[model samples]
Target: LPATVTIDQPAVLTASAAGDDVTCYNAANGTITVSSPTGGSGEFEFRINGGTWQEGLVFSNLAPDTYTIDIRDKNNPLCIVTLPETVTIDQPAVLSASAAGDDVTCFNAANGKITVSSPTGGSGEYEFRINGGTWQEGLVFSNLAPDTYTIDIRDKNTPACIVTLPGTVTIDQPAVLSASAAGDDVTCYNAANGKITVSSPTGGSGEYEFRINGGT
Candidate 1:
């Protein structure tokens, strides 16, 4: 005599997720990589988008895209595991800009200045360029005229990501004002007998003020 009876079958569910793409433009650090959510029958829950179902499977920060990964089997809630394949996290406008300079205190100065130092990544309301010209939200590039300069920065909410500090702002002047003069000629009408003399006044930085025709 032999007799036995037992048969139970309900175990086959698979769902997967893997994504990480967000290094700029609205960077929220994007990340998602669910670990265990396979096979049906009792205790298993992880949520995203619809929210609230935490069992933790790594899904941090996450911004700039679409995502939906819900797996439920708390004890057969229809034993769902729908993740057909659709999880994107993308952001690429890439931007990183920098520039700083202030030199030319004399000797042929336009008061030299080049400043635009607050640009990193996209989604910023920043736009400034000099040399390649015209695109200013004003980050100070006043007067400026002395040499090497190429500054460029863009992120007017991602304007094709243009960032170039190339020549790296270098404006210098002050050492080109040497004088040596002497003259004396009288007898026409004696306007102080016309005498002019200025000796050894080299370079330029401070103390040097003299005029003749403009009289001073």
Candidate 2:
């Protein structure tokens, strides 16, 4: 008769995720690549979010959320490893815009201005545009024409989060001025007191003033 003996060893595994913690709008996709297992000889298997085990060393097309990566040795089911890693996804930014300045004022005067309120979201500066024009810093729009305009706001860190708003500005011309004098140029100086009358100025309201020799 021959004697038989059995020996067993535990399995060990380690893995590292590729890329940063948060997936920005223009950043690369999140992924996890597992290294070869140690202390055992068996095929490697992986599973994400507690899903079915897959035959591969790398996982792709992952979203922003907490994930559970399970690694096990097919030869020895008891020898397994589990890792919990969180994948973060940035949220879209919210932007608000407002219009200011005179709407109905004197002609050739500065038109209404458009301003953008502070936005909430990722860090970095913000860009603005008016009437589908070029993008620029600051949220102010000056010397705008008296017409409707389109406003746009976007984050410098990410281009995916852009906000659009509709706006309008109006301007009016100043009133015209005209005056006439009702009196004869040649009047008998010493003959019966000469009479002179002044007509009210045109396009003027509130109060009227008559003066001679630039005096009030």
Top of the candidates by TM-score: 2
lDDT of 2 by residue, 1-216 (tens): 498787865555655444233334433355665555444466767777677787676776555555667776767666667754543433333455554434424334455565656544544667778767888877677665456666776676665556675554333334445578776555565666555687867653435677766886
Candidate 1 overall lDDT versus native: 0.77
Per-model RMSD to reference: 8.7, 6.4
Off by over 4 Å in 2: 1-4, 18-45, 50-61, 72-81, 84-104, 107-110, 165-216
Number of backbone collisions per candidate: 0, 0
Worst 10 contiguous positions by lDDT, candidate 1: 158-167
lDDT of 1 by residue, 93-192 (tens): 6676677888888778788898877676666577888888788888888888798888778777556556675556789998988789999887688456
Q: Which residue pairs clash in candidate 2?
A: none
**Model 1: clashing residue pairs?**
none
